[model samples]
Target chain A: MSVDLEKLLRPVDTPLPPYPPKVITLADGSKMVVRQIGRDDIPDLLPHVEALIHHERDYYDIVSVRVYAELLAYYRYRVVDEYVLIGQINGELSAIVNGRIYSPEIGMSYHTLGLKRGLRIGAHCFAAKMEYHIDVLKQEEVLIVAESPIGFRRWMIEYNLEKKFEIPHELGGSPSYSLTREIFNRARGSLIVGSRPVPQDLLDEAMEKILPPSDPPKAPPDFLAATRAKYDSTGTSIIADPKRKKVSHA
Target chain B: MREVYIVGIGITSFGRLEYPLVEIASYPSVVALQDAGLDTVDHLFVANMGGGRINHQTALSSAVLDHLSLWPAGSETIENGPASGSSAVKLGFQAIASGMCETVLVAGAERMSEVNQLDATDFVATLTHPMAEQIYGITLPALAGMFTRLYMEKYGVTRRHLAMVAVKNHGNAMDNFFAHVHTRVTLEGILDDRDAETNNPVIADPLHFFDMCPVSDGGAAVVLASKEVAKKLGKPMIRIAGVGQATDTHAVHERPDPTELTAVRLAAKRAFEMAKIEPKDVNVAELHDAFTILEIAESEEVGFFKKGEGHLALERGETQLTGKIPINPSGGLKAKGHPVGATGVAQVHEIVLQLRGQAEKRQVKDPKIGFTCNFGGFGNNVVCTVIKKEE
Candidate 1:
């Protein structure tokens, strides 16, 4: 008789309720369907997140790298009680948000990555994540942290999240912030959006496939553009490369 | 006076540009010089605001002149609140038409993005009256909000009218590559939909988020020359037919009628008189739509419509790209991105593009006459220019 070691190495995940899908009408009058995805769909989401790992603006590289790792860990049964949600606009993946249940009364917030840049797709998805933990799962609070200034503004400042400094977030050693039920309730009307009972056709379209994002953030064509934006009071960098043909006037 | 013509024009993308302020002003100068096939100008006028406070750089004209390598040319910086861009253009015209200079280059630029939003807002708020307005913590949006409410009460201009202006300008900006806002907003999305409240929150009372122009960093330049120089260039003959400026009481409460933009009316009247044309003769226009309500108010004040009926024309789609006397075919300041200093010159640039028939997709139908209204300090100071294309 031989003893099996594979079963003992993996941590068993606690059963959790599924997040109901909802639809949001974007500022451009387009429909976005947000729904929960299972572990099997993680592979389908990695390529898009992986592509953003090289983008240098707004800390997209760090956030995308962590999101890719989180997706991989969830897929390989390395993490327990994890949930993934995606937002799709016309069958195209627009954003990805994920988290994990720490206990019956607590949740651990992970990441919110918006594939589409300007239309506030990430803000809506992050709202959906908060809704999942507090409204759906009935947790008391969700511990959150932001890796970018955009995320900080959306989560900490917008929601007025309370400091959970004593508790360190899993992403890093930084002190965590807690989005208590009281805070979520206070910021509910303005920050939270989207309607329930999504129409069948729209839901079916989002479920059919997770197409690539139409226009995702990318590396700046001219590296000096970023350099000049951050520092460079001398103005010599631009003058030295006048004929570079990358002024971005258009 | 001799005729002053715009021989060349150029602009940069109106958004978050990550370059030095002088470089921002210099790039467009280079483009305009290349367009006109000129190596230098007799003089240069740079329009800028917030250079000292926001960017920690002053003497912008000296820096830009040196940066462009145009040493011998005289340079000056003009500051007139939001009207700085057009004021520079006006001075450039005066220099050429008065025979003080044969050629002048007018460049305007702003880099508001270098600072945070609150700081930028405060920087702009400094434009208000110090003793009367600033003491009360009044900002531009607050002033616009009060003006919009009065316009609504007196003129029956509803939120729907404002949304229409935003929708129209946003749609027009999609075709403008250099515009700041490329997102297309719908009536349903911004006003009618359930998510509208969240998507378009109230920034100032009665003025929604979309009703105001964005804080942008951009640059624009125009080369003004005498008629003889214009003839030799072989470019489109876009002559600056008229330039008129007028001022009003600095404090808003001092105005005879709070609802009226008297300076706009006076400036437009003088511009039309000097040009020997009426409002109806204008083929296209670019009004200073820093706030959506201003578009309606200025349209009426400039004699495009009855004092209280600009909204009616908007309802009739008379201000659309295909409508009669199409307004802001270059998206106006609402969507084109208002870089305070660059805005006035940018308006002239669009008018020149229209007169030259070079506005690719948003070009008006054979426009021969173009009008621009550059408003400053809540209409206390305004500059109006009328341009014509000669055969």
Candidate 2:
């Protein structure tokens, strides 16, 4: 028989418990169903991720590109032990979060992308991922890294994650931060929100179709706007008049 | 004194603006001048609070004058805390009415987002008594929270009543393209839902996250000129009929009646006397709702409703856009975003928009008289203005 190259190319996934689906009552009083999705649903999610690759604000471009690649790898069986979860508001995609099992005691955090932002949709999804690894899968720690300032504030600072400087992460070569079980447990009550056994109709609707995000983040209309912002080198005035050339540094 | 009319009004969107502080001030100046069909003014007054401390710029009016390319005219910066916007307009009114200037441009701006939220809060807290309040870490939210508690106890105002104020203003903002907060909040979202606790946390107990006005970056301007100058422009005659300002205790605790906004009552009385009109004559108003409670308290203090009955009037659908007396047709500070220095002028700008019959989607029916109360320093310094649209 010819050598089985396909078997060598695909890594075998370890059997893991499925993440229980939950529903969160959003600030708008609307119920959002957060549930795990299998590889078969990757085709429906790819277009949304691809659409956000060109968005230049708040690091969405970088995060969405990597997410697209990760989901594609998971679909093709090139990667092992991967999971995906999405927050859907009224059957519309509001946020997407994903991660993978590195080992029995360690977890790899991938990305958290909130399509409908300003309501902390990303923060809620991120909390669910940590819950999945620590509470559901019984992992000791989850390796995390923030690709955007918003993410850094939400995950690292909010949760007070520990820096595992020596351990390099898969997404970026930089050292990964560790969200230990202790840290996850401390933030669970307040940050971690959602109820088990998402209602039948809501679950059925979320799985039936993945609708496009109603409100998506957009790139700033003008980069010159940021350039015009005065940079206070020494707390001095950044918008001093040209005639006043002797303006002191902040 | 001669009659002073506002012939032009202009404003930038009240939100996180990316332009420089001076540009934020000058952008509205250019628009106001264009609206009035004038290229120059006899004087320019720029209203700002933290140009030096927050934006690291000083002598703002001079910088703004130069930035707008309007040199040689006299200019000065007016800093009166959050009331700076109306204080600048009051000065402009005096300049035009006293014949010191035939035309004047008053522009107010604040770029609060330059600093982080903590810094902005601290910068605003500086308005409180340094020794009495600041040393104890008393932010505006804390002060509003205490005031809300007392008001709730005495007036039977529930959290639902406050949420109603927020819901109304947010609904009003949905139609205002220049407003900062476009989010539509419902009573269930902030109050009834189980996630309401997390969604709208108690920022300072008794007042939730939705209760306070957002710190914003924006600019607003009004062109005040003599009646003759106004007639030459052929625009609607929205005269600055009256401008009244009053002061109260610097420390909120020092007042005998903590619930009473004395400055608001006195200033409104003075404005009404000057304008020869009662509160009932006003068809529309823009109250300083830096906190949702302020709208209820101020409405009563200004005689819009009997004391302790403002919330009831709100419940009666009286403050809506199509109600008997529409309040905050421009969304007020709650949803419109309070760029502190620009807020008072923005309030007056909305009144002008109403009097000119140009407040498109949220326009009140034939609003010939409009009112604005710009509260500053937690009611310590208050300015009230009455505007009339002449036939």
Candidate 3:
């Protein structure tokens, strides 16, 4: 249940400096605070993942638990450079943003399916992941390289992410697009990265330290029902404002 | 106002057919033309709700007209979801009543089985509010199931009461040769059928598969002609005495009560007012029984019974073929199959059959007046038409 991400981040260890947390104002005037993922944030992150899956049911095909385990293992054991952020509203996790620093050698393995196919799919995927990486890259002044699947070359054009070149004979028939720091920065302003500015190196380190060193977690029995029941009964409410008066800035 | 009379009515088997979209519609259109004893028609109104999504084809009216070799005449496609058939009928009625055309052929066709069940479900779900319901995985059946549960909770109705509706409709459909699914389904058979493969499995919660209508592929056509032209055709005519169409809010959440279909009540009121008769005046009625529970709900909405009494009526066999004011003697959508766009027109075709006293075994005895309730998007839009046998 515990994860130590410090070791993975040790390579890029720098003094933790003060930075404003990302704040997203919801339609209901509720504000969500975004910060880089930490070892103690699993419980907070679980609900967001569940909600996302529930919302995307009719739209996207999600990966299986086995695939998710593999991705987590790869991040914990293999990938030492990545980024992760969790958004919290009223002290409860509301969303998650995660990405890895992709090299041509490592980029050929991301699984894609269903509506996520097509050439541009890779670029969009890469852009999404890279945006998270940039959130962690804050003040680091480090160059990052990532590859997008073939067909996603237009994604390179749209984001103005310069194509370093394409990889041949990659996953399926899709090619890969390589992006550098300069192009990523140009595309950064247009993308809604939300409120988080963790160093990508720190996120990568944290993920590596926290992942289980051995086999995957055991399959939970009726986990969905159990979780839903727990949510219903807990009656725990996140307090937003102590005062009854609504905050007005007009 | 110019009087419009239905000179011809043609309906294909109200069940699954192996024919393609164009073929299904063509059969009924040809039959209607022959029934009307007409070599030509001035305008054609094609009614289909799912062809755009199921068949991936738009502008289907032209496609059907071209396929039937009735081209060069004005053709239009009318879609009001499941009520497309009734909408087409309204359009045709208006065309002739306005003196724009002497003869107008209205055809309703739907081929839903071609698509996979999940895809078909998703397509139907799109009729709901995209941001609110669709995003939450709410579907038509899910809403129907909710309404069924609420109706039962509020009215003390049991599942057995709902089962009687399917049993009655299926038995009635057995007498209907064109019925898509006709079999004697018992309350025990429906409640105990656990195997999804053998019995109609549960689609949405509280709604077993048997409780829902089949995704049929069929068509029905009615030829509307001016009174002069109908008299010359020398066929038994069914006078469309009154037609009323009304609308309500599309969002189910906005409605005051989910159990009662307010639009149906309003439309039926208008139709009865126009016809200068009451619900008692109609000899028979063909309601939109897309689901077993819908029949119960619609019956009350149409003022056929007191609120919350529809279930009791079905349980007592009051809505059966031999019952008072027989509902769905043509097997209804539950047994006859619901081809969406074709369902409303098929209701009209059944009323015509009842009025003409030609419904064979399922015919209501001495039927003089008939009523058809065609609904769109769960009572968001409704059209009720009253027809009478002409002397």
Candidate 4:
């Protein structure tokens, strides 16, 4: 069967928090710029999906770009209260974390996508999703699933998510675990989440316990470049706005 | 370190094996033990990098060891990408040197033919930096193509020079019964036969299918023993005079010079120094020739020729069977076939045969000193070993 090249190449847009939301400064001196997915952000999220599908083909049979485009379109117009978060360093889209509050009781199903180099930026995306799910969605519980043991386990331990139960072998073979609000809060005992707000401390402690000691942390070059580009663009947008210019002139 | 010698070496026909991966591995491991005249062994080190990816069989060492009924002898699997065979050799050497075991058996096997071409390419590319290179659609052949292009531009080496390495290896392979592609090709056959139906088409730019080694299924093994044990069990011996290994940066872009393999240089230097000999002392060399240009580049890196003069050496037939130094007397990987992990030990197996004067049709006469270089990934890690015929 002939493959549809465009369908294979199209990108998927991830869900994010509402734009211009209150920003939180992570303990590691990094700021979490949480915002909702937008039509304009489609271009920014496109390259990541393209790269992810291309890179992860060995692990998963990638869907067509048309499918991805359709998903993005569906998320934009049809999915209410669901959005994509583009995690940025400076202002670049280093990673994309998307999810929706499918139900107030059931919480959200979210996925994080980025280059391995952008893992740190992806962390912000994860934290943003967690914050949005916990505070914005205000759900009683939030659950996260990851294929890799290291990533999944780290998320569980970092966010105090409980290792509920592993999915059966028939479902993708890779294990899946969940965490509830009670378990998450218990794991974060005595350490106030909102008061401390040190993302680095949490990341470092989690990495030390979860990741192999010999393995060095990576900051993907492409992720940095994308984040820098986004930051530059955001700066330019603010400077060029007619309303902002008028205020400045006054 | 204690003195070590390869008392026995075993190699299956280096062409495609129709059997399963375990069967392919079993053949040589059994043969090596038989050749060494040992019914039992203390330790087993199996070298296979692709079995898991190709056949979805992880824990190959235990599988092979269990198949051979050599269970509970501290069997371990070693994987260092393509150079896995040599890495196993290193491990066996260390075991004997550390006085942990008096005798050790190391076997390397791979079955790449089972998978489709695209999947095989993806599997090999997994050895590269996942995010930087593989994600960017860079295949191993692409890297070889780039290296060939850069080497050609820098040294004024022509495609004909690269083709010469293929031609000579194929000619040499005509005598190597174990070689996969034995059909000899003329320079015209390479350059003019661009018709996709007739000729081996170029897989990557500047690299024809013929210029590349085949994705083969084969296995090879060698029995290592301490000098004391070797003397006692002596059938015929090839002393492991020296061994060297070195690693460079993982990413290609991080390398200082793409054309140069510093890992090879350092490994060879250490090997030669430990052997107390220079490159000229080596009578035969089975350097890693996964790609044709690799043979030329590795030759220069090992100090066989000046940086830019490797192509000239190949042009002059200096590396031919009857030339000053015969390279890949068992047709090398280019002709013999590269089963990834099996390649390095296969090289040693060929060298042992040459050193023992048992390489029937392709023997390097009066071969005294021999060498083998095993490269892992894209020159990221390398191991070089020097073997001398026992007087």
Candidate 5:
């Protein structure tokens, strides 16, 4: 292939400040390490993310498909200014977050996918992605959009995101909702979590390899599959979390 | 009077059921019939709390019997607040015990989730005294919070004890396939840690998020028959040895001692006397743990532990899956979920399962006696049942 043709196919990549990896204690007192991963790690991450494409509820199907494509673009050097952050619990993939630096002042949030659903895995991972935009790279705002009602509720409503309806997002023309530094700051103490240094052993294990998700979210059997979604709709029903997932499913 | 025995038990897992309120009752009716290998019963007792109020359907048993194609059998709806389940059991027991019917099916169900949370809470709040409590917006959690506060001060039970109850019940529920609660919450995550505040915020003062049972939609049933009928069925012979129901002041404010669940005490005493057994004879028990505090308080009220020492026993690992008198192995209301009308019947179903040695993973050690106390309206109205394994 000609150098000119290859250059035409891939957009120019911009230098991004590296994200400092951190760890957070989960509800069960287990530690989860949230750190950056590169395109080279996609081979390990793809098959796992691919497995969640059928989690029909909470729009995980569409989200997983979009996430798979975004990672593929990153792998082929087709997307510009892209960064991927992986959340691991003892070397297994828990969540993956990706976003891109759109310009000097603005950012584009691509997707946040959780192979594991509860324990706020996606919430924690989404916070890390926003942290990259408004805190790490110091972008003025990150354009965000939600494909699922859960995402709409958790991200758009929970964060009180501003409607940047005038702006279109990369995930297609769902008018974007934006997370500003002020909005990010307000949620930092409560929503944003995890600690830096990540305990050397935890970091060593997480970086050694992106292992498969131990219990990945699967297609709800039939349509009315006994799901964590029903189990999660309220607090008293919170028993549907995976610890009880087996009994509930069985 | 003839002795009544439960020859068949059936239950839909205690959680959300999108089915109509009637189906919640009928689905398990069919299962109970199948379990007994009986196509029909002489009578059916349907227990429900919010059918008319929440689901906009009244005369529930009529609908259930018709739906199950068990028409022409005598049917009635028994409504007794949250005690509807066991109250239905009592009626079925009476039917059999009086020789009015040799075989009866008592099914309990509630579609409480059909209404939104606020309306569902309001529907249940209707159980409170209208002028004294309901008019003032007194929800169950608010009432339990006050009760827990006074009990805590009097008994020195701490937040740790409540968290311990939540933790233990959650773990127990993991083994119960039909239990409503699933997650295993640690004390560190929901209590002692930095995120605990946000994670387990105070639903009521001293009663954190995990303190209360969830409002669920489910159904459970037991086929009660005469001893001869039970023996003929050739299923496990678990006798409904005793049943005791008692009511107190309709309003908590009217009671001489707010902390004492006198109804629970009296009801349990009556049940034990009738069963010819003491509280200590009960090898496995399921106390109503609608709020985590109730598990501690009811244990004392029912004589499982001395007053003020229920938490001590809880701390000593007495309530674990293999504890001395494992309570709420079905997870009680806290983890198993409380589908108001269905809970009491579900409790009796659990004890029957335990007595019959059919309670799979959450089974207690070999035991002869099991007891259940279904506390209703913050202990204003209570029903206690004792079931013994008949060798």
Candidate 6:
């Protein structure tokens, strides 16, 4: 536990340019602010991410667990050159995206976790992360991988990212895909979008505090409804719960 | 023919259900039977589209009948693409009217979520002319895109009009508990905003993401009985006053005018004629809106509005829940979630709900007569039905 041993254990962090804040209007006319968060802010976002570690649908469980670890590592100085960006709508956490600088010319995308569903919150935050690497930091390309099919469709197919199969990504050692500057430029106008210098009020609200998601994804009333239905054949498992009536927006 | 009344109805939540196809179909039948206070029906008709292809199951009616413990009751499976639900209902009507059965249970179910979106789209695309359309990679959306371009050029339907249909339906769906998409979207966000392009991305040119219906998994059932049987049941009688079906050229390009949904027109005309009521007399309607454009187009074709003026009526708010015609109070397929086979039956279920004054939040104003247009295969096949409540 000597100071020299502690110094040897912690990786040296690189100084990267800060990501400028931007605002995007979602499908429901809510404004979302995408801004980079320092390690100090990681605590406020951890509980929300941990809550989704057992979400059990749409690959949210795996993605949230990994993102939780990544955020924790960045907070504890366990990861090198990592930066976390969060999206907040009405000061509530809607999405989280994180990545790190791999080299002077390359970037590594860790994960994009959308706490809110159906409004493309994840997509906007993801574009901001890419913009951070290519537009701000001036990286040539970013290495990315998707843990969910929805992520794959949004990033790999939507951007037409090139394969970097030889390089295993840090998450799961999956084969990586490279989103070059050319690809980002091609998708800028249509896919990647946001207005820079976010409105003062919106930016201030986002920076105020990370509120709990008003309508987070919920575990089903019965986790094993399908399996139970298979065995019971009475179709009782599919019955509607008397208490839980409405599905909240994602 | 005799009078055939829909004595009881039930439907599953139209979304990504996590049960077997038989259970999906049978659950509604059980509910319908309970609603009718009947232990059995003389026959069961199951309507399903993708059972064999997606679920790897065949003889769906047999399985559903056995699952529901309606043993020895004659059962049959019906498939007519998206029109399968109404087709099965039409056959049930025929059986009751022809005195072949005292009562008939018709249930339509589709578990399209068993496969991914691409595979489900491909399976639905198989309804197209295989040699001409399917071979050329023609999905329903692709055909709809081409048709939309022609409709836009010919009738001046714009993207704004399409978005209006989506907005109206989604708003209507907010009140429908069974609707797949409960998310409320605004014109400012989906159309006019700087991020509208990404918020409502184009699935097909002239047709954005909101313009198309979500693929769903669900079931719906209606118990059709003879007038005598219906009277004995002591439930509100919603008679299937008319049923008409028509088919057009299999290949969309083969039609003389790709913009015209001639089958919808013909089928609706015949249904209205048989119902002894003009389109104006119908209190409410559930038009097929697999795509938002179809709502506008089918509205005109079904005689709710003049051709080329549907959008104008839409502009005037004529098809809203409180408007002149009040279309798709259950959000149609656009927001209700189209489980292909379940769509037609679900349409009937909605109409029945409206006629019985059971639709709570999204109910129309004292609807006495309700109509449904169940479109199949890019308007190649269509089934139209009219239902009226007996006073």
Chain B TM-score, one value per candidate, order as shown: 0.99, 0.99, 0.96, 0.97, 0.99, 0.99
Model 3 chain A: weakest 10-residue lDDT segment is: A233-242
- For every model in order, the TM-score on chain A comes to 0.88, 0.86, 0.41, 0.52, 0.86, 0.89
Per-residue CA lDDT of model 5 for A1-250, tens digit only, reads 6998998998988878899998877666677899998878888888887887876666788989999999999999988999999999989999999989989999999998888754677888899899988889988999999987667767997799999999988888879999999999998767887777778999999999888898787532221122123533212122213332121000
- Predicted complex 1: DockQ: 0.35
RMSD to true structure for each model, in Å = 3.9, 5.7, 21.9, 24.7, 6.9, 4.6
Poorest 10 consecutive residues by lDDT, candidate 3 chain B: B192-201
Model 2 lDDT per residue over B228-333, tens place: 8788887799998888999999999999998999999999999999999999999999999999999999999999999999999999999999898899989889
- Candidate ranking under lDDT, highest first, comes to 1, 6, 2, 5, 4, 3
Q: At residue A84, what lDDT does model 2 achieve?
A: 92
Candidate 1 chain B weakest lDDT stretch, 10 residues = B30-39
TM-score of chain B of 4: 0.97
- Per-model TM against the reference: 0.94, 0.91, 0.60, 0.61, 0.87, 0.95
Task: Report, to 2 decimal places, the DockQ of model 5.
Answer: 0.17
lDDT of 6 at A28: 83
Going through the candidates in order, their DockQ values are 0.35, 0.24, 0.01, 0.01, 0.17, 0.30
lDDT of 4 by residue, A91-150 (tens): 444455665565565455456653323123455456556666666556666656664434
- For B324-361, candidate 5 gives per-residue lDDT tens digits of 88999998899889999999999998998898888898
Tell me the tens digit of each residue's lDDT in model 3 across B24-92: 776677667767767557899999988888887788889877766665779999999988999899899
TM-score of chain A of 4: 0.52
lDDT tens readout by residue for model 3, A1-250: 1245655543442233222455433322233344555435444334333333333222221432222443454344444444445444445433343434444223222332112111122232334445444433432212222232222323444555443335442324334454445555765533333334534553344434332212111221221121124433211111111332221111
- Model 3 DockQ class: incorrect
Off by over 4 Å in 5: A1-6, A77-80, A102-110, A140-180, A218-250, B53-56, B112-123
Report lDDT (Cα) of residue B334, candidate 3.
Answer: 91
Model 6 fnat value: 0.40
Candidate 4 lDDT, B90-121, residue by residue in tens: 89988988888888889999888788657788
In terms of lDDT, which candidate is stronger, 3 or 4?
Answer: 4
**TM-score for candidate 3:** 0.60
